[model samples]
Target: MGQKRSTFLFSALCFGMAFLYIPMLLLIIYSFNYSKIVPVWGGWSLRWYKVLFESEEVWSALTLSLKIAVMNATFATLLGTLAGLALVRFGRFKGRTLFSGMITAPLVMPEVITGLSLLLLFITMAELIGWPGERGITTITIAHITFSMAYVAVIIQSRLAGMAQDLEEAAMDLGSKPIRVLVDITLPLLAPGMVAGWLLAFTLSLDDLVIASFVTGPGANTLPILIYSRIRLGLRPDINALATIIIVVVTIGVIIAGYLMLRQQKQRERDMQMAAQEVVKLDA
Candidate 1:
């Protein structure tokens, strides 16, 4: 009976994984197909890849998306880290509940609503101040940052909340100023969380389509937008190639992040062990 149950669980796990990954596997395989039609295996060739490389529009959209993702990741990490610090470290402030709720509102809000709300805000600001001239990359980047930062904040907050505050307290007790303690100790400890948040923000910004579409103007189509526009006609081999490329890039990033996280965990364990030994020696 136990053996049967174990086999059942393993089968279920395999089935779940296959359900999620088989489509991606097929897409990757078909990316190399020489035919314009997808899933229909024509002899494997680099024809679509060659065309993808030559398409100036695709490259432009890709470039724009990369720029926005990079900017959003950096800014979101900064703002989100600060917000997380505020929530975690600053205890019992006035309007703390409201501030926390506002910061996290993006996470729960529908994408369409977030996009429309941002569009409205941008338009209002533009009319009132006569700045930002028109909507385009800047608007899209800002919109992405607005939502992506919330995710980053939640990640950082969870990290901070789970962490022990003894090190921080010790450093402060040693006559270190709060700012110095944060800069020297807190920030170093939060490095993993910050990197995770940045990567999460980057992925969110790159994956965003609805928000980007609402914020982008003429000649500012992101890669997702370009793909959306083209797919309205029909799926091209070039799109398959593009998707394959994205899958490869994302997989690489995930691998790198996992490696870094594992390395950090090992380092942290070593540090704690060393600290324990030092404390034991002091007591002796």
Candidate 2:
């Protein structure tokens, strides 16, 4: 029975992995096909890559997406961190429930609804304040920030919840002002969570399509939007090449992050061992 169960689990794992990765592998392989038609396999060549690199539209869209993602991530992280701190650190203030609900509402909201609401808000703002006369990078970035911050806030909240308050209380007891303790103790401990939140926010912003589509105006296409439009026209080799490039970039990022995390874990283990040794020596 145990052997059969193990075999079934192993087979399930393999099947799941293949289900998720086989499509990506095929896409990467097809990206090298020389033919313009995606379905037809021509001899392996870098023709599409060359074409992709030459396309000014692709480059412009990529540049704009990166800029928006960066701006959204930074602003989202800042705002989310503040909201998380308030929710967790500020003791039972009036309207705390309403505030927390508003911060997290985006998480459960439908993309279409969120996009429509943001579009309406932008139009209303334009009519009232006469700012953001046209919806483009600024409007898209704002839209991304609105939803991305919810994910960041959730991450920050979970991190803060798991963290012990002993260090912060001790800092405050040792003649440290509230601001000083927060800056010295709380923020330092929250650094990893903040970095994670920022990365998540960046990825969310970059991957956004619906919200960006609703908020963006003429000549302001994001990479996802461009790819989608191209796909609609028909699958092109250049789209495959673009996707392959994105896969490579994302793989490299994942590998680097894994290496850093493993190194940090090893360093933490070594510190714990050294502390144990010192304690034993003191006892002896």
Winning model by lDDT = 2
- In model 2, the Cα lDDT at residue 263 comes to 100
Give the per-residue Cα lDDT of candidate 2 at 99: 93
Residue 58's lDDT in candidate 2: 99
Instruction: lDDT for model 1, please.
Output: 0.93
RMSD of every prediction = 2.8, 1.2
For candidate 1, write residues 84-123 as lDDT tens digits. 9999988889999999999999999999999999989988
Between which residue pairs do clashes occur in model 2?
none
Compared with the true structure, model 1 gives a TM-score of 0.90
Q: Evaluate candidate 2 by giving its C-alpha RMSD to the native, one decimal.
A: 1.2
